[model samples]
Every structure is written in C-alpha cells, then in structure tokens.
Target: MKKATRLLTPALGVGLVFGAMGVSAQSETVTVESGDTYWGIAQGFDGVTTEDLVEANEYNPRAIPIGAEIKIPDGETSSDNDVVTHVIQPGNTLTNIAAVYDGVTVDDLFRLNPGIDPYSLTVGSEIVVVDYNSEFGEDYLYHTVQPGNTFNEIASVYDGVTVDDLLEANPNEDPYELTIGSRIVIPLN
Candidate 1:
C-alpha cells in the first residue's frame, strides 16, 4: 500500500469551537481520530513546534481518546461565523487540504466556493478551511460526470455526499457500471 503524504503544518493551539459552544468562528473543534498524535497534529499546521504541543495540555500527543472534540486554533480571522479561511501557502493545494480533512474532496471544496479559481490558485489567496451549514441549490444538486468515473469517485467529488447516498437516490442504476457521458445527481445539504 502507498503511504499517505503530509498535508498541512501543525499548531500547538488545539481547542474546540462548535455551534452553541460559544467558541469563535476563527477556530475549529475536531474529535481526536484514530492515528492522531500531538506530533501529527502539529505537523498539520504551519510554524507549530514540538515544544508547543507539549505545552497544550488539552491534546495528548501519545494517546487521545476517540470522540473527544479537541480545539484547533488559528482557523479563522473573525468571530461571526465558523467558516475560517486560510491563504494557500507554498506547496498547498486542494488535494492537500482534502487529505487533511478526512471525507472532504477537492471538488467538494471548490464547488462550495465558486469565487476561487481552482486551476489558477494564487499563492496567498484565502480559501475556506471549514464549510459548515453551506447552501445547497443549483451548484450543489447537479454534477457533470467525467470520463472513466465510478459512482464512488463521483460521490467522493462532493464533501457531504457518500457512495451510499448515491446508491439510495439512484436505486435502479449500478454505480460501478456507469455510462461515460451521463449526468450524475449530487446529494447536497
């Protein structure tokens, strides 16, 4: 099997920010997932040192329990909504961001924000880090299927949608055996 590539730099300021928790929008709250370590989290963000992770008592570098929503600092710029934006730094891309946030896809993020130019991403342009409670209408409901695509690949194109969702919606059609030039329905919130 191929090894996973590194995504973002890590930060010591790990914390939680959920709705009704009164946490600001600039931060995020993430449950400690399997394979997460202090060193690993720190390496996900930029300029976060090992010593800083040691200082943040909330995060257990060695072993963090599942379902524990730890605070992830340095996400947003303001405190109105929780969707934080981060400028694309050197070596940053949609692929890297999606890798960092499990279940998120490059197309999912790009579709969420039409303002961004995916093909010509600027080095310092800001991109939304977290897209909570996003709108679902014309942009979210439709999808143009590309060549050599499966229902799973098409489903993974959007963040919230899953292969099961596609299967459920298109009960008659087999996702695996799909035509090359067909329009696929995108499950959206």
Candidate 2:
C-alpha cells in the first residue's frame, strides 16, 4: 500500500506535467513570505490576478502557507527585458494605460495594483508588467512558492530542469522547505 501510494504521486505529477505542456501557456513559480497576501503578491506583476494566484497555488486566500511556491501564468508579451516598469501618472486611466500594450488591460492594472483605486490613479507608483518570449533576456524566471512545492516537485514539471538546478539558482532558499510566495528563479531549458 505504501508503495502504491508513493507511485501515485509521481504518476499524477507526470500527468500534470504533460497536461500543462499541452497547453499554450506556461508558468513561473514564486515563494510566499510572511505577511504576504494574495492581493499583495498579485500586485507585483501585470495581468496576474488574485484568483489566478489562489488557483495556481491551490490554497485558501485567507490561509496561504508560508514557503509555498505559486505559479504565475504569462500571456502574450515580448521584450528584451523580462519586465517593463511603468510609473502611474496623473490622468492615467487603466484602460488607456493597458491600451499601450497588447495583452495588458484594466483588470491587469487592478491585479498589479491592489492599493490604488482605478478611479483615483496615483502618480509615481511603480507597476511591473512581464514580457513573454523576450529575445535574449533573463533565461530563468522568478517563481512564487505554493503549497506542496519542492525543488524536485517544481523541476518535475519542466523539461531539462532539476532540483540541483533550482538549488544552484536559488542558494538562499532552503531546499527542503520553500517559502510560500517567495521568489525563486527557474532556469529555462
């Protein structure tokens, strides 16, 4: 029974990996820290929703585990850099701001900016928008920790990535227990 139970985990994990690969979208994982909220974490990037963060980590919004890595999905983006930092200015509407980018939207502004109200925009607040499929940019991505995540578990989903790679990439993180919603770098294949 113990053997079967152990095998089931890996089997299901493989299925998940394959299933994820079948989709057109890919994800980066990140670790959660103390006092971090879904709303706060989602604010760090453009187009990342609190619901998406919750769904990816598979945790309750109220009680997310510290050290768990969460997956942040990327949409259509392209740039030489992983992200473009845009400062919110006076007279900026979320729709108008998002209109400047192909995949960005008013919802994206809300997702990436939790404290600020769309109706009353704040000037000088920085918002980060991620660029997907950027040419010759940072190969590794920043991943958020979610429940039931380990270096091995995360690596199992990606092609040609390993626990050792994760360790090497993120020497600061404890390999045994990753911090939930904390940032971990994932090396690309």
Candidate 3:
C-alpha cells in the first residue's frame, strides 16, 4: 500500500504540472495587415508587449511581411489604463510629445511607436505616448540592431540619446561596427 501511494502521489503531481502548462500554452493567430507593426498590434491587446509578440512568432519585428500570420499569445485582455495615445499636433515632434508626459521619453515613444519617421511628423496622426505595462523597466530599455541599422540612426530615434551613452552602457560593443541581431542598451535620461 505504501509503495502504491508513493507512485500515485508523483503521478498526480506530474499530471497537474502538465495541466497547467496546457492552459498557459493557449494562443491565437492573427494575419499581419498593411502598415501593421509589432508594437501597434501589441497595443490592441492589454498586458502584451512587442517583445512578447516578437518572441512568440520569432520574426524580426522591424520586417514582418504583410499578410503573414503570427501568433498572439492568449489570455491577455485590453486595458485602457495600460496605454495612452496622443494625436500629433502642428509642430509636434517625438521629443515634444514625450516632453508633455511625465517619465515618458523619446526612447519610450520610439519603442511604443515603431516604424515612425522621426523627421516626418504627420499632423493628426495618433501615436502611442506610453505603455505603462511594458516589460522593460523605467531605467533602461534594450534594443536589438537590425540589418542596415546604424548607431547614429538608433541614437537619433530616441530623443536626447547620444551614441556616447550607448557606448557607455555597452562597453564591449563597437558603435561603428554594430553586429546584426546584437542587443544594445538605450539608457533613459
């Protein structure tokens, strides 16, 4: 009887573990549309970050082809409190838009609103101001370099971020010889 009890206990524990895994593994797929970015899609769902969507699909966030089907992890719902959007006004740059919000930076704007041309501000276009539920913390955010990405371009996207700051955070990485798919740290000022 003792031997049977021991075996049953371990088997029951294993069953419960597998059951939980099955529940968490639930996910749904969505087709990528024109002008759809990973960050933009994540905004439609609450508690889901661009990183989550990217990691789940294992695709380059910067170059997701249109009409491609991607997996969106299930169980996350939309929450209005988690994200806020701002409509661009005349003379509004990412810098000035970020300035209007406390603790929001150009880096945050770039991360939240990917694929936006910093030099071209379309008046009346809406962009995400802040994603309070982002997996990244307040002090810094991590960025991965894509093909044809330059240190200067990366620095230019984030307001007030200089190549020097990126160098300081990443001591071993050479800004001039940035490697594809290498991670860079962008420190928030």
Candidate 4:
C-alpha cells in the first residue's frame, strides 16, 4: 500500500464551537487504509466523529472510498493531557454539552468530571471532558465500568471498536466479569 497522504480540509458546516469540549474546529486529512471505514477512522479521534466526517466531507456517512483522503475537522488531539475542561455556563447542562461534540455522552462527561453537582453548577465552574476526538493525540482511553456495562456495550459507544479489539488491548482480564469502577484500557490500534 502507498503511504497515507496528509491533507487538511475544514469543509463547509463542519465547524463546531471549541468551548463545548475545548476541541478546535480545524480539519485535517487522512489517507484511507485497507478496511478503513468512517466509523473505524473515527476511532482514532475524540472530537471528530463519524458523523462529523459525513458532514465535513459532505458525503454519505455510510459510504467512503478506502483510498480517498478526507478532512478531519477536529483541532489538535492532545500534546500530552488526556482531558480538557469545560467551564460550566449559565443554564448549561451536561447532556447539552455532550451533544455539542461527537462520540461523547453525558455519562462520559460525568465520568470525567467526578462529583459535579449537575443541578448546582456554577457558571464558571470547570469540568474535565474525555472527548474522543481529542484522544487521537493520546494513546488510550480509560472506561470505568458501570452497572451492566459489557465490552460490547463500551465498544458500541465508540464507533467501529470491537470486543476483540478491547480484549487485545487488555489481555489479562475477563471481559465478561469486568469489575465496577475498575478501569479498562482502550488502546490505540
């Protein structure tokens, strides 16, 4: 296979507010690899999700050419820090905040910002965010088990990630019996 060419495109309507999760709205290009898909390519990012890919590339989300290069409009992933803080705003809600970014949820927001009183949030209070789009610059993701959470379920949350991939990332543990609150590593593939 030829080397993956890097190109940048912040094509129309793909921009998002960085304040949502501190993700810059700049887009970059990635050369498609064998077996690559929108969902699979999104696994490498925290902010730029598969949905964003469809919107940014202005193509059908379900169909993308493997050898074609596409733009990724997620700002820089991370230089070192794995998390970003979102300052609580007046009338802000975790659910709303999570909706502003792709591949993240209110539960994820809660998980990263522990002990946050959702109802009593101050306008300027800061909360950590585990934005998936930003994880591209990082190495792995940490998933805290909740009641009834399975590897399949967690993998489902992150587009194109599978139980087998998760298992490969964590070889010493039992996927069926994951302990609650225990950390599970989602390694880069």
RMSD of each: 14.2, 15.9, 19.3, 12.8
User: Which candidate wins on lDDT?
Assistant: 3
Candidate 1, residue 52: Cα displacement in angstroms equals 16
State the TM-score for model 4. Answer: 0.33
Model 3 per-residue lDDT tens digits across residues 1-189: 001011111335666767744334335566777777666676666676654564456354656787777767543543354455776778888887765543457987888888989999898788887564463367787676775788789999999999888878666567776655445678897
lDDT of 4 by residue, 1-189 (tens): 234344443534434443344434444577776766665666666655444454345333334567677776553443323444555667778876665433457787776777878788788776665534443336777776666999999998886688998898666457877644344677655
Task: Give the 10-residue window scoring lowest on summed lDDT in candidate 4.
Answer: 75-84
**TM-score, every prediction:** 0.33, 0.32, 0.36, 0.33
Clashing pairs in 4: 7-29, 27-73, 45-132, 45-133, 46-132, 46-133, 46-134, 47-133, 47-134
Q: Put down candidate 2 lDDT per residue, 1-189, tens digits, no spaces.
A: 001011111235666767745443345666777877776777676876553454344454556688876666452332233454455667767776665443456665565566766777668775654333342246877666777788888988788998888888766567776655555678895
Q: Over 4 Å off in model 2, which ranges?
A: 1-137
Model 2's C-alpha root-mean-square deviation from the true structure amounts to 15.9
Model 1 residue 49 distance off true place after TM-score fit, in angstroms: 19
Task: List candidate 4 segments past 4 Å from native.
Answer: 1-80, 131-189
lDDT, model 2, position 149: 85
Two-way lDDT contest, 2 vs 4, winner: 4
lDDT for each candidate structure: 0.53, 0.60, 0.66, 0.60
lDDT of 1 by residue, 7-122 (tens): 35333255433323544434434456676654456456555423233333333344567656554445232343324355566777788755543235677678766776666778
TM-score of predicted model 1?
0.33
